[model samples]
Target: MINLKEIKNDLPAGIVVFLVAVPLCLGIAMASGAPLFSGIIAGIVGGIVVTLISGSQLGVSGPAAGLAVIVLQAIQGLGSYEVFLSAVVLAGAIQLALGFLKAGSIGYYFPTSVIKGMLSGIGVIIILKQIPHAFGYDSNYEGDVHFVQPSGGTTFSELFNAFNYITPGAILISGLSLAILIFWDQVLTKKHKVFQVIQGPLVVVVLGIVLNVVFANGFPQFALAASQLVELPVASSLNGFVQQFTLPDFSRVFTYDVLFLAGTIAIVASLETLLCLEATDKLDPYKRISPANKELVAQGVGNMVSGMIGGLPLTQVIVRSSANIQSGGRTKLSALIHGLLILCCVLLVPQVLNMIPLSSLAAILIVVGYKLAKPALFLGMYRSGWNQFLPFVVTVIAIVLTDLLTGIGIGMAVAIVNILRNNYKVSHYLYKDEKSITRDKYRMLLAEQISFLNKGNILQTLRKVPENVDLEIDLSKSAYIDPDVRELIEDFKETAVTKNINLTIKEIDRTTAPTDEKALL
Candidate 1:
């Protein structure tokens, strides 16, 4: 079904994604407190295995920063990384079961306002997290996304800290790298054929490596520290590379604690994967909708394979997916190519990857973050209405203050409140026409589905009926009315005579309904 022209477009994008992924994988592994090579292995498996099986064309999968804290705690609880790998295998099995059960529709329950809030919040977090890296302050690991640092600093405080410890060499490289990215995105891609074949991020990475080398040999004053570069473990030989892959300790596989941890990982990873799937589909220029259940299957299989090869758990990652979309990737071929590129880099030339400066990649991510959380997006959401703007802003603030899942929960709670408020007001309408000779003509029209939520509204309307008024309660179109509502209606009928009100109930089958006074009571 794929055409060669699509492949041509995806090739360049794939390289760019690979370039962006390298440091992220390394940084996520470090943050997870796992062996650094495990992240690389997961990236490879996510790219090759998940991409092949995924219904998504643009989504890229790998170890996510969202799972860093969970992974770290899990490793500590299990007492060994090998035991955690076993839990990952169990999690994959659980995900496979979830896929077969068709649990993917759970993603639909998330409100659009909350989802948009999540995207923008993540964008803000990305920008905040990468600022220190841009300034060459490597106090935190590369892929750390938490608002509060493990080193006891808040996101805002880190910015101030970064300013105090700014490295001139890193700043210079980052500035030039950002300029090149902007030029490539805005001008070069449109003006030249070569720019279409080569992405700006790739160029920035190459130039960064060359610039760092120049500073190291000729201009020592501008030389960057070792911490400012990508840090992939250098394998000396074939056996050394083979040793990087670890086997899970299956002895602890069935332990109660292990099973519990496995279940937790499965639930969290599945939720994250589904969220990213929705976000990626929204970002796709083609407006392609990926099958959420099928994505779970792909992720499950990917995690199984990754576990067997000592890799971190895999999920659909928004950062890489957004990068793929922005870089003009047309098919899953880009994801596949990026995975192969990671494999090739690990096997052939890790030194070249290490030559890449962290600042350049941070520049690329800063641009990506800007696209997600642009000022225009905030203004547009605000203009929509308070209902949309409130959740959107709350989500952004919550995500920036907490983690991704927690922020989304806060946003969803706010959205649910808005829904309840609207429901309370709009469930029914009581009005009288101005032309009516009898001013006490009250017509109450019930909503299509009236549950307990509309109970108080119906009661209030009944209480407000003036003396000698002709009240008409309409439920002709209502398909389902709750028992409590029916009882209330019956009670109102009994009280109607006391108020001297003439009440007419439409579409009521009193004979078929329960007439027991106890039932009404």
Candidate 2:
């Protein structure tokens, strides 16, 4: 049920995603040491194949930067790129199994604060990664997300080096492109439908080409080198294009090592896809939730196809999805069209695409990054209180200092601590009744869930009961109680008799209390 009417917006958004995805696909592939065409294959399959199968309307998938290191290490360990592809194929099958088995429900366990932090952290990373490209330093590939670079410098060091190798041409293109994009998105699109249809990014990509031509002819100093532009593996003929597709070595697919690698890939790829899918849903303006299990099936199929015909492992990528959302994409049609556009343009006129300056794309991405990590988002999170704000800020900082997965793990830990701390108060009601004070009586009402985590607070409350007092421990509201909690209550019952305090345990769900004491009232 593709909404044909939304094509007006989808078509333009598709074009924008295509523009943003091109170098990323190539860069991620190159970073992973896989053939450049493999990345394109993954991108095309993920966009077209996964879009048709996935329930996510706004999510876009392709070769993920997160998997670059894994792919690189796996390829080296497996002894060949073909062998690694076999693992990718098996990995996809495992993902399909996971989807059917409903393992995707793991996504629901992620706290909201952590998810928000992931989005903001990624947004921060995008800005940091692209700043060098925006400043005309193309030494770091566009898809490199790691803080420690394989190219021999840290993220900050790259930024420092970018300034030294500053290209006047890159500066002009990125600076002007950013200005025009801001004007187009903020002003022009609002003013006219024609401006809306003709997106700011597309305009700047074209402008970059035209400007580079002008620089080459009249101002050589301002002309970017081939290194500073989009680099695609130009396939001259149908045969040449066909030559890029590499088949996996199926002979080793069933081996122990290969199977182990496949399982690892399945777990990592599925986790990354689930995370990105979660993040993408948060960014969607329609507030529509994508079916997570079905999304796993789609990603599984995409990876299988990618591995079958020479492509890196793919996942639901947040950066491209964010780009699509920001570009007004309303349906999967945008992703499908982006795939079609990549296939057609790469086969037909790759050289023309190669002309579009990296600086221009950098500008577009930097703006997207800014939108995700907006200052207002920080203020809003802060107002949400320490529970939400701490994780959000920690996620952003950790992501910048480390990488995506590590940062998320750290944020999740922080979020869980906050949850437990809040639970300490609300898990049980420990208030002394005013009416009971005169009679040396007290009441404690338990929460619906009384886990072992609630034991500490409940113990303190229990110890506060004085000698010669009547205390009522109410478990009527409790649906579940940890054994540790029950034991604690049992221990308290013994002490109550020694202190000459009358104790009553009401509404216990258990059929039998300890044989030593009839504690239940």
Where does model 2 exceed 4 Å of error?
508-521
> Could you tell me which residue pairs clash in candidate 2?
none
lDDT of 1 by residue, 1-521 (tens): 33456877899989989998988999999999999999999999999999998898999999989888989999998899999999999899899889989999898888778888888998898899888988999788776778888878888899899998888889999999999999898999999888988889888998899999999999998889988999999999999999999999999899998999889889999999999889888888888999999999999998989998899998999889988988889899999999999999999999889988999999999998899998999999999999999998999999999888889989989999998888888888888845568646788888888889889988997898888878889987676789999999999987889988888889856566656775578
lDDT of 2 by residue, 257-327 (tens): 89998998899889989999999999999999999999999999999999999899999999999999999
TM-score, each model? 0.95, 0.96
- Kindly report which residue stretches of model 1 are placed more than 4 angstroms away from their true locations once superposed: 1-4, 434-439, 508-521
Q: How far is candidate 2 from the true structure (C-alpha RMSD, Å)?
A: 3.9
Write down the lDDT of every candidate, Cα atoms only.
Answer: 0.89, 0.91
Residue pairs with clashing backbones, model 1: none
Q: How close is candidate 1 to the true structure, as a TM-score?
A: 0.95
Candidate 1 deviates by what RMSD?
A: 4.3
Top candidate when judged by TM-score against the true structure: 2
